[model samples]
Target: MERTAPRPPPAVDPLRYRWVILGVATFTQAATAFFVQGIGAMGVHLQRDLDISTAQLGLLLSAAQFAPLLGFLVAGELLDRYNERWIVGTGATVVAAGLLLGSTAPGYASLLLVLLLVGAGYSTIQPGGTKSVASWFDPSRRGFAMGIRQAGLPLGAALSSAALPFLAGATSWRATLLAGGLVALLGAAVFMVFYRRPPHVTVPEDGPHLSLGAQLAARFGMVREPSMRKVLLSGLSLISVQCGVGILTVLYLYEKASLEAGAATLVLVASLGAGVAGRIVLAAWSDRVASRYTCVMTCMIAVIAGMAVLMTPLGREPVPASLTFVWLGFFGLGWYGPWLAYLTESAPPGKVGFALGMVMAVNQIAIVLVPPTLGLLKDLTGSYTPAWAVLTALTLATLAATAPAVAAVVSRQGLRRRPPYS
Candidate 1:
């Protein structure tokens, strides 16, 4: 009989595979973020067991954020040079290692050091995941895809918020660190095993690579653009609100609203749950709207309203306080989806990773500083009201500064045909 040709393997579908990438990216994001996101949930335990003040508690959280200040810039540069699968997977592994080490921490200072290492690892995930999603999805679906991917943060946060406190309450705070490490290890393994770059994209081997100084100059130049400046401002302001809410929600409810610890934690969970939903809904809405920036602005307005409500007499009541926090969570956390999509769209050609890294690095200044500042305000004033007032005023000031620029951009876009991404 005549020999038959061996059958060729079936080809993978790019469209179907993109969803796989999305799932992996989202899962890895959630897993890597599990411990950090749960810090707020552990506030009561950390304060009780460590015998630390609120400022110290805030400092503990800030420790995890501090390394990301410089790490994001480095990670961004790496993303532009390397494959995300390895960068993100390795980052998650580092997070696992840091958390595992943190479990053995003898005191507040040691825990802070461990979390600083964890923050270094976490710096890779945000820009790496954003760049990966943006590469797969075009403008029309980018916002929605970005939204789903970004939702992983709050999804992980919500799960951690619900689980960590219970774990800490049942065992000890150290056990919660161990649990977070294991989860991060699992996430790292999944991404390393499954993630692959889109098959169609190619890296050019013949192009001249820039020197370190030149590359740094080019990345810094992005800051000079009006649009980028706006993004930086918005990120700084809104992230302060986000961190404030996460750091203070349970404490505020427990101390000011007269709720029990368990009840206060449940409210934090509800707020994070709202954030997950808001990210998806608002990003999808951005897809239909004239501008993604509009969605971000809407979030700003909503956050201001929520904070204003929290400052009122009604915030003292359990029902009203819970409802208002949920509202704050929705807009404050949800804003990241549309805002990231906007940032990705705003990047100059061939520099998405660098732009993300640079802008996010600038934002980290707020993330690191705000938590401690808010905590100190609460400590000095002996009230949560001053902290809330500060966040409200910061956000309001940013809105006022950026409104005219955003409005002009919107008006200009309205007069012309809408771009696919914008």
Candidate 2:
């Protein structure tokens, strides 16, 4: 009898449909982030109209960020248990309602409350989108898809940057805020209408499920692994990048660059636009590079950020002003797509959502912690140079840390192999 070759197991059809979910996911990010980030565009207006001090304005901006920190933890756990459409759609509605109410907010206290809602809004997008995207794209295409999705954030910021400043001029700040809020509601409806979670999976062999205490312990256990530890460090890098881009970039342009407020806003907005491209380019190309794309991102970020920090006469002239912001924008925003992809991929399949949440949680903690620390540094030193110096050190430290991470990943596989990308 002829020996029969073993039949190739029927290939499981991957979740190609999840890409549609990604499309909707993009809008949700754009919608929610627009309201929160629009503050930078309207800062001058808020200062003038509300008669708030710079520090007070910073607090309001920071407050929006603060509420979202807790969401990383809560949303992560909930995502693991619930239907994403309901969770995300509901969060979006709440976000919309909060901003609408804030549009007519009578006092600083009300504005703060509205901002709290904005943070809640931000919390939904990532936990929902990250897990959703992971289901559709394989590890190969992940960098691209995640990058594209992340690009929405910059797209949203750019839209707000371009539109809010002009809109603020055209009508009251309340109108601008209301307009953005309404757009977010539409985002909720779109997500509810189109986004679907991947079907529930049951492996032929069920692994032991993690209890709450067990899960936390497992999380710490995962963290202790050298590869996972790199993911966490990358996540911290993410936090610094977020602080630099989302909050500090525009401020750096306006005050330090001494550009007129409108021009400063425009330059920073241009960078946000570039981020949309950077995400697409860097992410898609990540799959083809010699090294795993994360390494490239790690290297690129260190070089660009270090140069930006040391570009000492940064805003002293127009050439440096334009170049620095563009360079800063590239480094600051470009890393999100890959680092997030890296974080998602590095995680075990069963625990991916929770892993992502942990990263986001750390990211939020950094968000809450970093801006204030940077602010205090700026306040005491009376210059951002010292602040930039500190960030520069951290950036370099991240670069040095990558070697061990790559080595650990290699040791696990044994012998030289192709990078994770094809």
Candidate 3:
């Protein structure tokens, strides 16, 4: 009998594949989040162009968030059962196409409808891209890997915040959306072409796919786990702070700090750039220290400190205010790096997608409720103080709730000994 020829190996080395996945995950994440985050930067233009109130503009951001409340769960389940490359790539395509179609939107209502579609597509990117990166890196380096991937959001947002206002000024809001859509499509193509599952992540053919009831039950069951409860609660309080910071930074600077529109937007871009750096640095620190919760606690402390500064009269001083907002941007967004790493580490085996989905889905509730509420508060009170104070209290609450977990990690000398999912 003739022997068959030996199978050729893949072009990239297995050892280097994880980094390649990280790069793709990062780009896709940045691309998917670009338009929504850019919306915050374009607030004044949207108000003038669309002739809508602050509340209505807030609603636009809220609209993008609304769909993720449920979409996250569905995407999570699909990720557990499907290939991430296609799920993520397809989702990005949807976002691009939706925005392309949205460019033709006739009114604020039509734009809202278009944003709804963008959110649906975004629902896939968080869990799918995260799960894909998590699969490639073991716990030892997962935090660092995840941080790099998550940084994509802020990095993309920073770039968009810096560019979209100019684009809108030169062209039209519709044209800006068209430009963002094109970037998102490019991201989708990159992810589809380059991403590959790790060799160790083979799916078993014999096991039955999770039934809907079983999947729902599994998700509910995650809520009951003690560690998961802490993670969920931490996310609940922390996400409000994150959303408030993201949505209100430019507005707050323009209105309260007496900055011109261009200067305020420049400040917003700088803050998001800080956030990009913060995610990577904080997550890398978590990996080195092997204490995800400690890193989270550190971030909470930083946020509280930053918020306290914001609450004072001194925070309104132009130079101080810009510095302070960037400080908050660091911790507010930085917390997510370690937070997500801990969440992934805590997940039960084969359930990273579900855990990430459920936790982030619940977090999305805060994202939905908080920004608009803060916007309304700003509208009603004619001040950002109430919003900043509320965020400060929320951060305090999250720190208090997560104390026990952080203490446990500290007691262990800041090292996790086992796979949290196991």
In candidate 1, list every pair of residues with a backbone clash.
none
In the range 293-390, model 3's lDDT, one tens digit per residue, is 77888888898898889889988888899999899888888878888988988888777787888888999888778877997898899888899899
Clashing pairs in 3: none
Candidate 2 local lDDT, 324-411, one digit each (tens): 7676666567777777777776776566666777778777888778878887888798877776776666766766786665766556
**How far off is residue 112 in model 3, in Å?**
2.3
Q: How many residue pairs in model 3 have overlapping backbones?
A: 0
The better-scoring model by lDDT among 2 and 3 is: 3
| Model 1 CA lDDT for position 405 | 89
Question: What lDDT does the true structure give each of the candidates?
Answer: 0.87, 0.72, 0.84
Cα displacement (angstroms), candidate 2, residue 203, comes to 9.9
lDDT of 3 at 405: 65
Give me the runs in candidate 2 sitting further than 4 Å from their true place: 1-16, 199-211, 245-263, 290-293, 296-317, 408-422
Each candidate structure's TM-score, on Cα atoms with residue i matched to residue i, is 0.88, 0.85, 0.89
Q: Is candidate 1 or candidate 3 better by lDDT?
A: 1
lDDT of 1 at 49: 97
